[model samples]
Target: MTNDPAIAFRVTALEDNQPNGREPILGGILRKKAVWVDESLCIGCTYCSCVATNTFTMEPDNGRARAFRQDGDSTEVIQEAIDTCPVNCIDWVKFEDLDDLRSQLNAKTIRPLGLPPLR
Candidate 1:
């Protein structure tokens, strides 16, 4: 992790979901957004599971992380999984809205680290 305060703040905010914080989108006519995990980058750490156990799971075979839609789960749970990702491999795709909240959250973390903002 970097010593940048902005990066630190983003990490904390993502973990806590600050007030006026971004909300995860749920099922609607538009498909609910999801966080895609990168199997290659994942170290098999279950950090995401700590935040949203229902949304994320570790595959015993590859030690890669997986995300799925759980019954009665809200969008926030998904966001929590994305936020907790240590390697930052998760990518969010919008099913309906042009602007996906999951992508935006990822952007915030990258931008402060001087990382190219995701499109």
Candidate 2:
């Protein structure tokens, strides 16, 4: 949560490409954006946690990765974690939409180990 504002801004630099027009608020935006891991799509690889220790943690029960702390690490580190996801489950998302994503996650069934259904 104590990440540098510049680094945070660098993370939001992609905000320009997004549809939302939310203006930068310096410190206000430190947690404005976040990385999301779809547990249903998660493969329990733990690469995200390994890359962004502060931001991600592995779930004990399901053995899936979760975004436990928003803005817990530098944006670069979190992005690295996203890139390491072999299943392409991790993604960048708007802060406000998190609740809905969580709701969906809550309703979803985690994909079993070994193989996932074709998209």
Candidate 3:
């Protein structure tokens, strides 16, 4: 392994090109589970961003990662990102529950990097 620090996750063989992160989203077009990143749990490691280049992106202000486009990348690529996450912040959620989850997240406190905490 090279010490380049650039590579996020390695796909050794062609067989490794499967979405082994979670069970296949079988069913019709309306799949219930979709990928999401919990900003509160994110460590801003950038591993997800590097792995899923088109799917995940880092918020400049907080340095935390978020899923910009749900279908930006392939399932295998996104799975790799989710798996490579050291904090396991990335996850799947129901489409109908996204609003509630967002509301809950909004109620939580977020302390971004390079900032002082309030007293």
Q: Highest TM-score among the candidates is held by which one?
A: 3
Could you give the candidate ranking by TM-score, starting with the highest? 3, 2, 1
How far is 56's C-alpha from truth in model 2 (Å)? Answer: 0.6
Clash counts for the predictions, in order: 0, 0, 0
Model 1 / residue 40 / CA error / Å: 1.3
The Cα local distance difference test for each model comes to 0.57, 0.77, 0.79
State residue 79's C-alpha deviation in candidate 3, in Å: 0.9
Which portions of model 3 show Cα errors greater than 4 Å?
1-31
> In terms of lDDT, which candidate is stronger, 2 or 3?
3
- Model with the higher TM-score, candidate 1 or 2: 2
For candidate 3, the TM-score is: 0.69
- The 10-residue segment of model 3 with minimum total lDDT is 20-29
Q: Write the per-residue lDDT of candidate 2 for residues 36-74, one digit (tens) a residue.
A: 888988889889888888778998777889998775776
For model 1, name the residue pairs that clash. Answer: none
Clash pairs (backbone) in predicted model 2: none
Question: Which stretch of 10 consecutive residues in model 2 shows the poorest summed lDDT?
Answer: 18-27
